[model samples]
Target: MDFSQLKKEIIEYSKTIGIDKIGFTTASTFDELRNRLIRQQELQYQSGFEEKDIEKRVNPALLMDSPRSIIAIALAYPSKMNERVTSKKGERRGIFSRASWGEDYHLILRDRLKKLEAYIIERVPEAKCKSMVDTGELVDRAVAERAGIGWSGKNCSIITPEFGSYVYLGEMITTIPFEPDQPIEDQCGTCNKCLEACPTGALVQGGQINAQKCIAFLTQTKGFIEEQYREKIGNRVYGCDSCQTACPENKGKNFHFHEEMEPDPEIVKPLLKPMLQISNREFKEKFGPLAGSWRGKKPIQRNAIIALAHFKDETAVDELIEVMNKDSRAVIRGTAAWALGKIGGETAKAVLENARETESDEEVLVEIERGLAFFK
Candidate 1:
């Protein structure tokens, strides 16, 4: 069996299935990634969402029996919305980062991966394969980088020359010993743009990040965001794209190759006040298709309250007050109270003073005081 010919065949078939870019690499254990991850663990930089077992994340042999190669694929997503949402002064909206704009990328990548898997199975019935997207144990960036899909960028994203960093990455570990593709040279040289652009200074240095401080990670948290980051989060409700947007390589690199990845501007950039009032069912029905909705609405709503505060949107003060006074969740009520303070008005001040008297949760009371302190 000529494995090289088979690898060439796989690449051709991948293009037919809407895979924008595909590359192959030997599946030997990722030594460099293991060292980097260990250092990340030492610095406590991990987001807590990653696979806890570091070995499982770096060693392909652990994920599958006798893994010989990894096939890495990148699907480009649009960096710009094709249509524009009307901007009105009194109406405020929060932005979901470009990555979350379209249909959930996990499903898109998984569907492509399933197709690739089936193709391989037909060609080589004995071929064993295991695939994973972002949630998988193996680091997608590491696989893509080694597979020559892209160079690992300073923003911690795999940046393809054709697609820039705006690409969704997934990989398959297989028994076939496909010839490896050469990795692209790291071209980020002397450009400190991504690190400099990070609002939270989450990019501690080039190619290293403290995920705990990243706005993208913060927006996904269920608890109260620290007061310092609340202001830095700006109008981003789902994720942060500042670092990627700042990259010189990414300039003018927007691609809408996959229709499923095109965003509906109204849904991805919906009005902020309505988000504060969204019922769980309504939130699901409206945002269920987008990747940003995976963490559910609480985090998005919390960030929306922060965005209102960031905008000082006087129109939203009343809705914020309702959330502050009536929302069942302490985090929601507390975030609303803080936003009310930030969006300060006589009504907001009066409500905060009254809520201070009635709010039971200690954390909510602390936020209420934080809100009231803004008046002084």
Candidate 2:
């Protein structure tokens, strides 16, 4: 069987199925990335989200027996929303980063991979394959970098020359001995823009990120946000785009190729006050399709309260007070107290003074003090 011809056919087939970019590479152990992961763990820089087993992440053979090569795929998501919603005074909106704008990318990429897998198995009946998107153990960026999908950029994203850094990556480890493509040359020479622009200094250095400081990772956590970074989160409800937006390589590089990736403006940039009180089912109906909703409504709601604080939106003060006085979740209730203090008025101060006597949770009481401290 001519594997080279089969690889060519796979590339052609990939385009028909809405895959924006495709590349192939050997299923070699990612030794460098393994070292980086160890170092990130040592510094306590790792977000607890990643797969903990380092060997499983680097070795393809562990994922699937005797995997000969890996195929990497990328799909470009739009950096700007097409259907623009109007923003006006008295109504503050929270922003979800571009990565989480449209439909959840994991499902979209997985659908593409499932199609590709079927195509490969049709021709080579004995072909064995395993695939993963972001949730998978293998590092998608490491595979894409080696597979020539794109150069690994300083912002810790795989930046395709054509798509900039705004692309979703996925990979398939297979037994096919397909020839590998040459990797792209790094084009981010002498550029410190992404590092300088990071709100929390999450970009420890070019091509390295301390995920603990990354706003994108922090937004997904269910716990209360640390006070120092609260203001730095700005109006971001989910994920952070500062580093990607700061990259000059991404200049004028927006693409609307995938229909499913187009965002609904009102949902992605929904009003902050309404988010404070949105129901579980209501949150699902509006944001469930978006990637940012993966952690469920609590994190998003908590971030919304913080965004209201960031804006100092006086109009949201009433809603913030309600959340502080009535919300069941201590994180939500405490965050509302914090927001109320940030947006202080006679009413905000009164609510906190009352809550100080009634609030029971140790963590909530601490946040109440942080809130009241803002008044001082």
Q: For model 2, how does the per-residue alpha-carbon lDDT over 140-184 read when each residue is reduced to its tens digit? A: 999999999999999999999999999999999999999999999
Worst 10 residues of 2 by lDDT: 81-90
Per-model tally of clashing residue pairs: 0, 0
Each candidate's lDDT (Cα)?
A: 0.93, 0.93
Error of 2 at 47 (Å): 0.8
TM-score of each: 0.99, 0.99
List all candidate RMSDs to the true structure.
0.8, 0.8
